[model samples]
Target chain A: MRSSVIIFPGSNCDRDMDVALKKFGFKNQMVWHNDQSIPKSDLIVLPGGFSYGDYLRCGSIASKSKIIKSVIDFANSGGLVLGICNGFQILTETGLLNGILQQNKFLNFICSNVYVKVKDKQNKYFKDLKKDLLELHIAHNEGNYFCSDDELKSLEDNSQIAVTYCGVDGTENEKTNPNGAIKNIAGIFNKNKNILGMMPHPERMIDKYLSGEDGSLFFKNILDNFK
Target chain B: MKIKVIVTLKNGVLDPQGKAIQQTLNGMNFGNVEDVRQGKYFEIEVKEKDEKKAKSLVDDMCKKLLANLVIEDYKIV
Candidate 1:
């Protein structure tokens, strides 16, 4: 599979995402944010980092970058687009995904491993996946997701909710919620499910020695789905 | 014209920074301190000569970029 990771001015995870995609047998290319067009690829990724120094708002400036139009066009056409952490913020800013990520409830940057429950597996991202619960790493200050009540209802009705924060034994409640996101939502999908935006970093967990192999399952699963 | 705009979190949206500031003020002996809600202000210098035109342009800016309508409201003053 071929993947393109867009690198904004302050994007720090583009290389890591490239490495992870390459490790999982994907031909990955790093695309600059100012570029007008992206190379042909099966997947497009907006990696995590404080884009434009998280200026006015997280991902707000980066969402208006030159290449974002192409990204939006790709997603509108049912192409696979994935945004992780700050990338997720950009997705919402671009209106490709629902809701906005607010500051953490305690106003602190949280960097730790979190368990996320797969909410819906009918999409291409998680279809036929072996595990229902996956341990992933989440690191961000504005990861608290919020949306209007009407929007939330539509998401729930359409199974647009992709994953949510949970406990090791699959218990989900206030105690397990790290950033006070609405409904402990860690990730969500567009109505078409072609676009996915989440606050977790799967690239950071691709290695078992350094982190864990659950991220491997994630990457390998996508490659499998692509095939 | 210099159009002044204020962007604030909509009612019912949690403002952690504002809450912290409120608590800090209370701890510093301001016992009657009420709730605090943080907001952003911007002064936009528009080339448009008409006041209404300038404000309308700024309103577009607020909707497009300044404030996220999902949780914030932008007011032109």
Candidate 2:
């Protein structure tokens, strides 16, 4: 499979995504944010980092970058696009996903490993995955996801919610919520389920020694589904 | 002409920074403070000389880039 990881200015996790994608048998390419076009690929990733110094709201500026037009067009065509961490913020800013990621309810940057329950497996991203919950790393200040009540209802009704913060036992509640995101939403899919925007960094957890292997399962699962 | 605008989180949206500030103020003995909310202000110098045109341009900017309508409201001041 082929993948592309867009590198915005100050995108710290782009290389990590590149590594993760390649390690999982994907031929990956790094695309720059200023480029007007992207190479054809099966998957495109907006990786984590403080894009545009998180100015004017996190991911707000990067969402308007020259390359994002092509990204939006690719998404509109039903291509798979994944946004992780700061990338998730950019996706929401671009209107590709619902809601905005506001500052944490406690007013602090949170960096930790949290359990995320796969809310929907009908999509390519998490389909056929063995585990119902996965341990992933989340590092961000603005990870509290909020949306209008009507939008939330529509998402729930459509099974657009992809993941929710939870415990190892798959219990989702306030204690497992890291940033106070609405309904403990850690990630969501567009109505079509081709686009995924989530706060956790699966790329950061792909290694068994460094972090854990659940992220390995995530990457491998997507590649398998594509094949 | 310069267009001045204020962008604030929509009513009922949680504002953690504002809450922190409110708590700090209360700790400083500003006891009557019931609540606080944070917002952003922007001043844009538009090329249009007409006040109406300048305001309209800024309004578009707010909608497209300056403010996210999902969680924020922008007002021309």
Candidate 2 residue-wise lDDT, A1-227, digit = tens? 88999999989999999989999999999999999899998899999999999999999999999999999999999999999999999999999999999999898899999999999999999999999999999999999999999999999999999999999999989999989999999999999999999999999888888899899999999998998
lDDT of 2 at A113: 94
Q: List model 1 lDDT by residue over A104-172, tens digit each.
A: 999999999999999999888998889999999998999999999999999999999999999999889
Q: Judge candidate 2 at residue B34 and give its lDDT.
A: 88
Enumerate clash totals for all models, in the order shown.
0, 0
DockQ, in order, for the candidates?
0.97, 0.95
Worst 10 residues of 2 chain A by lDDT: A201-210
Q: What is the TM-score of each predicted model, taking all chains together?
A: 0.99, 0.99
Q: Judged by DockQ cut-offs, is candidate 1 incorrect, acceptable, medium or high?
A: high
Best by DockQ: 1
Please provide, for model 1 over B1-77, each residue's C-alpha lDDT reduced to its tens digit, 9 standing for 90 to 100: 79999999999999999999999999999989999999999999999899988998998999999999999999999
